[model samples]
Target: MPTSASQEALTPLRPYCGRFAPSPTGRLHRGSLAAALASRLDAHAAGGRWLIRIEDIDPPRDIPGAGEDILRTLERLGMPSDGPVLWQHDRLDAYAAVFEDLKAKGAVYGCACSRKEIRAAAQALGLPEGVYPGTCRGGTGGREARAWRFRVPDRDVTFVDRLAGPYTQNVEKAVGDFVLKRADGLWAYQLAVVVDDIFEGITDIVRGADLIDNTPRQCLLYEALGAPVPRYMHIPLVLNDRGEKLSKQQGATPLADDDLLGELERAFVHLGFERIGADSIEAFHREALRCWADRFAEEPA
Candidate 1:
């Protein structure tokens, strides 16, 4: 049994916390509004909790006040979270603790390769680009540790996406010894996300299909950490006229806080649900959720 202090450091006891984690790289665009609406509807429809998480782990990518702006936008859209918002930056200590545990278990090792080196090695091996070749896995040959990486198991990581259906990836061949911490000192997404999900007791993760590929990596982390993996649902991408995903980097416009109900109807249609006229924001949720339940038989969350 863990001591009281260590127990406090472990995952909190809770149930059914589903979250909408958005990187504050830019404002809440139309695409982001859809994700928030889906997560809120699924959580509420299933009598679960909906939480907001600011994924500001990459400081250099974060725009000034983008996270706060997203919160305001969610409030304006009538989709407020049911709990205190989680900011990744505030949970660094928690992530560091998990890192220490992994290190002690010998599940992770020092890596000395750069992105360029990995890409070059991948090309030479005729493997997919961006897949690390695990050159430094066997002790890095005494080279200075530039990063820390998990030693991926040879087996496959597989799971059924609630919307997109079954998926699989062999981490060793497809991704190879993925990073846990970067040389520049940022915690890797695979580590921070799994740690936060376990800590928050998240039961479901609903987001855009653009992240479908990353799910397997996260599932592998969940297994390594002895945490139960959550069900996943990767919804269709909101595409611009050019068939590109609607994103801040793609110049998608920020959502207007004043157009809550109107945008709600728009998102409903965007998700292929029946459009509803807003008598009130509350009624709008009822009608929209009815449409969702009709489609999914039950809300996945």
Candidate 2:
């Protein structure tokens, strides 16, 4: 079971291990850079290990050489991973093992319903739209299984975010029985991410607020697997002109190669830090680390 807030306050802090996982859909944009920088600063402030992971599981959307490009960009911008990069595509065996384990525990089941069918079932049953109605929970009715879904419990999951404070979500109502593996036979993000975080011993996850909704589902997975849930800090996203979160789909442009220090400074300010006024990259990082520790230090136990 997860430690309660009261219990957590009494325990010593764990060895800090953090990661910045980015999909290889395109080059790193300003928004992604801000996320990477914030994660790096947070880890450095805590005197922890900060690593990188290439979330390249979905081949259909992945660009050729994009993973390598992202790693190269980080290195050029003076924010390289402290450890070896974990490529999700190379960890298929690990995901498969976790899937098998969930199956053995009866925490996941075959789901044959298509999107259209699920919507129809939800309408017929008067349930909220887009939330799965557990159509195949009892059985697939002899229909060929098109996907595998995790059986979310009907209860509230609450967790504390370093920046966003305490939050709760009832996973079963918000997302219902979410897919563990898609109809196309690929591992789902929730399963892959939780398994990888466990394998890597990630103690903290600091990323963009765009992923905040994914936390509750992941927390449930951690409980089902009997693994400890990590601390999270969901920083504000760098939005586009339309106020939409900047993303590849939103036509966000890649980070420019010229003036790396200037670009880093912009990202630093976007993270709510005052201008460090450092002439060199090394000096800038040094000052940024000090400033980050001052502002976002962990509360006293």
Candidate 3:
């Protein structure tokens, strides 16, 4: 059993908390806006705190000022964070602490294999591609530790998404021992995200559908650390002319500020809300909160 101090470190500050965490790679486009609006509305419906977190852990991919710009756009849309925004870059120590806990518990190991080595090994052994073959799980064998990986249980991990419904994945078979920290000396998204959500007491997670596959990995992390798993709802993605998910890498345009009402309307419609004749942000949110609650407020059966 953990001592009181260690237990306190893992406890959430609120009973219900939801967050919209956006990476600083680009400005908030329509796809991201819809997700942000949904998360805020869900929090409002649940009478919970909705926080905004800047996922700026990947400095190389982050635009220097994109994070601040995203927050400004959110404020313009009348969906500012409920509390001071948490930036992942500012919480390295916290991530390290959690990693140490996992390491001490024997739930993680050092991985010395490079991506090339893993791919080659998988091809050679006829293992499914992209699944680590446990090359370094035993020990580095005189090689340097390039990254830290979480050991996954062999059984299936199942969870019901509020919007997507029942979902399951065998993390060990599908993703193998996934990374907690990278060889580049930066924390992995899987580790940072789970740790942040746990520390913040996030009871619900609302994001894009593209991230559905990442849930099982995070679930494993939460279980390993004995933290409560948050409920998940992954909203649909906004597609572009090419029928591709609108993303920064896909050259998605930054949200135009001139027609905030029109933008919000489109986002609401994308989330399956009927168009409303709202003239202001306040009116839109008022109706949105009602619509969202009517649809998703009850716990999924």
lDDT of each: 0.82, 0.88, 0.87
The runs of at least 3 residues in candidate 2 whose Cα sits more than 4 Å from the true structure, single-residue gaps closed, are 1-13
**Clashing pairs in model 3?**
none
Model 3 residue 95 CA deviation in Å:
0.6
Sliding window of 10 residues with minimal summed lDDT for model 2 = 3-12
Writing each residue's lDDT as its tens digit, candidate 2 over 1-301 gives: 4323323222324788889999999999999999999989988888888999999999999999999999999998888899999999999999999899999999999998999999999999888888999999999999999999999888888788877877788878887999999999999999999999999888888899989899888888888898888888899999999899999878899987887788888899999988878898888899989999998766553
lDDT, candidate 3, 29-54, per-residue tens = 99899999999998888788999999
Per-residue lDDT for 246 in model 3?
95
Each candidate structure's TM-score, on Cα atoms with residue i matched to residue i, is 0.92, 0.95, 0.93
The all-Cα superposition gives candidate 1 an RMSD in Å to the true structure of 5.6
Model 3 Cα displacement at 153 (Å)?
1.3
Worst 10 residues of 3 by lDDT: 1-10
Full-model lDDT, candidate 2? 0.88
Locate the minimum summed-lDDT window of 10 residues in model 1.
Answer: 1-10
Which clashing pairs does model 2 show?
none
